[model samples]
Target: MYEVIATPFLEDFLVMRPGKSGGFKIPFHRYQELRDTAGDRPCPEWLAAATRKAWGVELSGRSADAVLVREPSSYGYARASYELNLGCNYDCPFCYLGKKEFEGLDWEGRETLLGVMRDAGVVWLQLTGGEPLIDPLFRETYGRAYELGMMLQISSNGSRLHDERNLNLLTQYRPYRITVSVYGATEETYDRTTRRRGTWRQFRRGLAAAREAGLPLRLNVVVVDDNAHELDQMKALADELEAEHFVYSNISPTIHGGPEALSSQSDEHLRARKPFTGCNAGITHFHADPFGLASICKVGRDEQIDLVAEGVEGLAQLPPIADKLMLRTGGCSGCALQDKCGTCRPLAKRYQEANAPLVSYCQHGRR
Candidate 1:
């Protein structure tokens, strides 16, 4: 019966019941009109009924109900990326996580955190890696969120998802969506990207098991220089599986601000990427590290606010802070190399070792 309200950046308002796993989206302009109507309005019966019908949950009136008010801005936080734990099995060359040190809130703490986020107006929660399936806290946290009706999204490498236990877990919780990163279409390409042989076979096996279990699955291909040739094959494979797919080519620096992984970005990768534009980090989206530290998003990892210490109430204090932190620097404000620049301030800062280099983030042809 908890009410979850989300105002996504560049999008509309999403009002949901996480305990029921159902919600609705409303345009910001219309939401504004609704917000002006005033005092603690009870959710419309139609919305509640539609939600319950969609997610197959009853509104028991156990959790706190939520209603959005006119905040300072139209965009409100709606989505959150929860890094259950940073430990991953695969060693992808282009991975941004680097070597993750395992740390996160305990099961009880995780449960509390979910409730806090729900209260704070987050409706869409993306459970991500290293590999969310491998996280020790995954099952408990996921099961609890399912019980509470959180619209969950999972990002995984498809390594452990084939296990019968994991497949059954997916069937039980029924996440709204599951995104698996397809490293390559062939074993050789997979090995080249992951540096792990025979993982392609394991990935296929897991993907089949998940599909057999009827899990809602989506595919994402990491378009790296090494796998650039296999893009067609990857898309064909996704088509063969009848799964929705997308390609990721923007290779940002590692969390440690190192350039070693940047070598994976090729000229083709640079050409394929869309131009740097505005980000919805602090305004509409956020990321929580394994240690319960929250930030605007993954790119802004360095600028973090401890969620465990401040609680949901602390979430209110971040938008203004994030606005201040989004400034461009290192001669990027009006650079003469605009024609060659391939990244924005946050990325430029990371690639330049926090110095904000004057050149593009891509080192492939530039060097």
Candidate 2:
């Protein structure tokens, strides 16, 4: 909670290099419009410092208790998410991980990843995928991830969670937390948003099963044009479910296609690459394709910075050449939110490099 005054203000953020529609240059004039109608009394105290740091030294307005911490790194009572799987079942138009050349993944990638985790002393493994539950490799991957003595973070569409057998299996795997997509408060909305039928029921069943199983849970909602108006309803559903935590954010442009590519996209998109502003890839974490072709970010899926070879071991393994394979590079140097944006490198190809800086993304979103 913070303060709000009558003042006009504006600021630029970053998504992926390209905009949302797989194209990059996205001018979110909405911020300017919002500021003009906003007051300048004082932002909440919590948000003041974060705003200053992300936007650079000088910020005229006050603040609030917004995001300004390193919490997005490692979650839970304790542990960090070692990346796994990239394919997802949903294809909301606003999805960030563009339709990449995902095909016949060598399951060996998981074995290699497990080895890396063992060497790095990683304790928590985050499981994601085109649909991790559906993947035939999950049985092996789950066992391996568990064998590494790491807590697993399972993020899913929630459709599979409802199966009693699967739910029991999940219990055996002992995932630390299950983050599910909260696309809508009703089935009609969810089915349309996910571009599939009968998904809403399955997803809800999964979430309920997880909750009943007492798996610590969090809910993620992608706030977009089609659903922003229903923010309250979404929250209400979370409350009804008694979720431990619920988060809402815009679809990131950091993956394959940027937000602009989804111009015809609906608002109920889900998040692919976790949202962040100043994406210091390899500095702390690395992204990976199923085959274990590590990328800097998810958008400009490049191959230059493959950490899998030497593995995310000591600092020396990650050379000084921190190229923008996934995180963007162009417009970043001059952007006000440079340190706080999820500037994906892939976005460079999605949109004209000229307008990257003027873009906006959720800065280190989790915190």
Candidate 3:
């Protein structure tokens, strides 16, 4: 088993340890030198010393296999997010996924999908879902991705973090980070927001257990009308756990273009987003839904490439698709404030389709 991964990140080379965040960036020559060394040979002196200093792991006598060197790829994506399943235990009205249908590929299909991601040069992979931890094949999927030399991150609601089996598995094979969503600080408010009676207790227990286990955690403070009054309390709770956190106030329409979720947005807490800067969504990163449909990003699901059927070769179609999606052609066409608009095209289209008021996403609405 490899302890470190030497892979090509976008335009640079990196030497990173498995299950850890942050790594050392090396020049092409240095990467080449390490790659040329035989895998069965003893670990290189520089690498051994670096690992000892950085992670306190002594790689002195270990063979070069201690470091897995990934081959460079013509495919551009270096990061991707995969939805393992869409089933959840709780029902939050503000969920953008709309329908929480529990359906996805079988284990064999999942393995093949992961293989395609690896071949496409995905180095940083995020495992997410309605509740990824509850997926029946969570352990198998996570283990396979780790074995394929991809650093893993997870997004969850934190309801199952207290389970002994989950805690044990996560501790043994660490994730770079687990991002948990915080609906409210108090039990009543929390339960009301999720529309689940006992979720507040489970979430609290899970958070405490994860903190005690010394896991890297980040809290996404989901601000909505139901929990808006508890914003400060929520932040305090995150601080009490000593976890990193950020506030999320903007609410979007459901994936099917329904405006129902927009009603939950907290008016007072909502703030304008930064200018619509270009992103590498489809260019250097992509999102895979439960069925292995690859799209430019989560919001732009209009055009999807079936990775399960076409494999990595299908990724070639994404760049142009990304370009086309970014253009302001519909309600946004011929607008003078295009450069100042904060929302991206695909997202804007969703709001327009839902007949959302201008103030929700338009610069003119703010004026």
Candidate 4:
């Protein structure tokens, strides 16, 4: 699909600042550097076309900085988890999706999901699951998703894409983002971690199919202790495929290093957990499960602290879940990281022993 596939510049972007000991680290220099570099680069013609088709925007008013910060949430004008079930078949110990049997909504429920996305003004509809390719409704749901005037983004385990029918159904939409999960670059480590045989091979083939289908792909490398050293190699592969690469933040906690404790073979330094260290979950982007909605990180979906429909748009609904959002160990009230940190409640509970600060994050003094 990409015969000429000319390389693109990676210098125009910068990583999000990691929280430092003194205070939240904001890389103003990198931020400014990106802003200056952005104006010089001609935005991709395809991206401009995608944005215009999805949201009917001129794409001329946009800036690169806005693209980076909100890119995770949307592809351009389209923003949402539309057509998404967010389920996963593999039990990656570190998966923030947590463990659950595959579940999905009937047609009516699916419409409700779309309704919320419309309310949120989403232009791109993402269809994810415990491997969306495995869903029985895959073709029908996918067709309907694009019919809603939302560009399709599909996240898959890559195992089933080998089926020509499945591949054909997906390629028909002309997906804007196709994310495939690959834990380890090498087959041994990848298969061992997943406890499933031939996963890496299937993943590679799926990626090939995506490229053949002319889909823009992004590869997700969950950084665990095993694959941490090859992070550069993974990035290299991404470059070779001309696909974007992302190192997913760990979902499991770091306080405990046992197999169960260490969710995967990635290298992730735990971020400090401070009570008053505020999170942008409810305010910025919230996570929702079937029951209701989680106010904090996606892992906190089980806790179901806040309902997305309860009238909280941004920072206003945090107080309702304040207690559940607290640090169990030192019980921080005003730790500075409170505002900038993910403060993933599950990480704290999973990593720390009963009533402890999350192992991956900083501990505030007991209130």
Best by TM-score: 3
lDDT of 3 by residue, 13-45 (tens): 998987689998889987887788847678888
lDDT of 2 by residue, 220-275 (tens): 86566655666778888778888754565534453533444345333354343443
- lDDT string for model 4 (196-270, tens) is 788878877877877787767788866676666666777787888988787664545422322353545233533
Q: How far does residue 345 in candidate 4 sit from its true spot (Å)?
A: 6.6
lDDT of 4 at 298: 44
RMSD in order of candidates: 5.6, 17.1, 1.2, 11.3
Ranking by TM-score: 3, 1, 2, 4
TM-score of each: 0.78, 0.63, 0.98, 0.61
Predicted structure with the largest lDDT when compared to the true one: 3
**Each candidate: what lDDT?**
0.70, 0.51, 0.91, 0.51
Model 1: lowest-lDDT 10 consecutive positions: 61-70
lDDT, residue 300, model 1? 74
What lDDT is reached at residue 33 by model 4?
43
Tell me the lDDT of model 1 at 1: 26
**Which residues of candidate 2, in runs, are more than 4 Å off?**
1-86, 100-104, 257-280, 297-319, 323-329, 332-367
TM-score of model number 4: 0.61
